[model samples]
Target: MSLQDLHGLLSNLQRNPGIPLDLDWVDSIRVNRSAAERRAATLPARRTVKKKYQAAWLLRAIACMDLTTLGGDDTPGTVRRLCAKARRPVRQEVLAALGAEQLGVRVGAVCVYHQMVPTAVEALQGSGIPVAAVAAGFPHGLSPFAQRLDEIRSSVAAGATEIDIVITRAHVLTGDWRALYDEIAAFREACGEAHLKTILATGELGTLTNVGKASAVAMMAGADFIKTSTGKETENATLPVGLVMARQIREYLDRTGYKVGYKPAGGIRTAKQSLDWLILMKEELGNEWLLPDLFRLGASSLLTDIERQLEHHATGRYAATHHQPMP
Candidate 1:
């Protein structure tokens, strides 16, 4: 389906209303590292969509991206520019040449720090793209508990409709499942109507098993989405880690009948990598999981590369990266 068609489809699906904690289900989770690694190794070699179909898949990927700017140097001007890009992610000529100009294509959302939420909101007003703010002591998530919750509230008040909270990695490392659950649940309550995405920081969670367990706990504790990383970790959003999290989401849905979204952020900067992640979602969880509501690529430069590829498809030649600058 085209991005325009998918937009209407996503509008009708209800947001994930979280369920109560189920300790047994959480504890039963286990990750077979070798098997997961082997499966991830085969993704790139397997599914390869080409030509017009490839362009279609690329458009779908664009609609599922969270165009992001999380650096300490981010300013309102930068956030506004990012929002503008979010409004029209691809060049009009490229989209028109592909016969996709009428589709009104755009990225899934604009992710930024709390300070940039208002700017993003204002820039994206009437465009229907949500402003997602990374809160609750982002990156390390080591601040005091009260302050973290307060930060979420403040971001929401500032017009952020999505709150991406960082879970205390220590909770996962120490086997403090209850603490993690309570912390995430409280963050959910603070979110009010906004969606909550719990970042597991899979790289620092020690093992794939820990990543699986943490994913289950966060879902049980009412995380609307389970994110793979904060994009600041040394190793972030690997396919192996994404597979573990995706399986956990499938397991949670089977047990509770509540579908949780999955996001793999950090280091996903290429068009091929985007297609790989899309194939993972389709094969692992089915086509329904490929929508913006259930999947988002946390990226900035990824859009630039995707645009370059689409231009190549339209013109039969690749353009220089400088010609496709991101907002």
Candidate 2:
């Protein structure tokens, strides 16, 4: 289906309300790492979208991206610039050439430090783009439990409609599924109306089996979305890890009839990689998962590359990287 057709469906999507923790289901989860790796290895070579179709797919990627800025040196000015870019991502000239000006092309959200949520919210006002905040101690998830919940509340109070929270890796490491589930459930309650995106931080979770199990517990505890990483890990958002999580999402849907979104953050920096992820979602979860509501690409540099690709499509030659700056 066309991207335009998805706008309405996104508004109508039912939020994942969560269910009682089912240890039996969580314990039953498993993964074949070699098979997952073999399948992931074959994705890029197996499918390709070129020319005009490639441009369209890239545009969809832009719409599904969480245009992010999570640096230690981030300032109010930095966040404002990021919000401006998120609002107008692709240049108008490039969009006009592709006859997609009316596609209303824009990134899915502007992700920033909690301190900058109000700045992003103010900058993106009336743009219909939500502000996403990384909370619950973020990256490490080691803050005292009460403090983590307070951080979530503070961000939500700051007008962040989406909270991207980090899960305690220790819980998963020790196979403490119950602890993991309760923690996520409490975070979901604190989130209230704001969507809760549970970052699995899969990179530090030990194995693919742990990745699958953590994904199941997070979804079972009511995460509106399951994210692959905090973008801080040494290894983040690998295709094999993404595949395991996608399979878990599919299983959750089949059993509970609730759809949870998937996001692969960090290490995804090229336009081709964006298409690879889009293909993964489409092939694994079908067309519905391709929409921004159910899928998001959490990257800051990915947009610059995508804009460059779109510009290349609009004009036969590649433009200088300066022409497509992202904050």
Choose the strongest candidate by lDDT: 2
Query: By TM-score, how accurate is candidate 1?
Result: 0.97
Clashing pairs in 1: none
lDDT of each: 0.90, 0.92
Runs of candidate 1 exceeding 4 Å displacement = 8-12
Q: Residue 167 in model 2: shift from native, Å?
A: 0.5
Model 2, CA-based lDDT:
0.92
TM-score of 2: 0.97
lDDT of 2 by residue, 1-327 (tens): 544455334447898989999999988988989999999988898999999999999999988999999999999999999999987898888989999988888888889989999999999998888889999999899999999999999999999989999999999999999999999999999998899999999999999999999999999999999999999999999999989999999999999999999999999999999999999999899987888899999998998889889989989979999999877
Residue range with the least summed lDDT across 10 consecutive positions in model 1: 4-13
TM-scores, one per candidate: 0.97, 0.97
lDDT by residue (tens digit), candidate 1, 1-327: 557555534346566666777778777878889999999989988779999999999999999999999987888898888898898899999999999998889988899999888889999989888889999999899999999999999999999988999999999999899999999999999999888999999999998989999999999888888998999999999999989999989988887788888999999999999999999999999998889989999998999999999999999999999888975
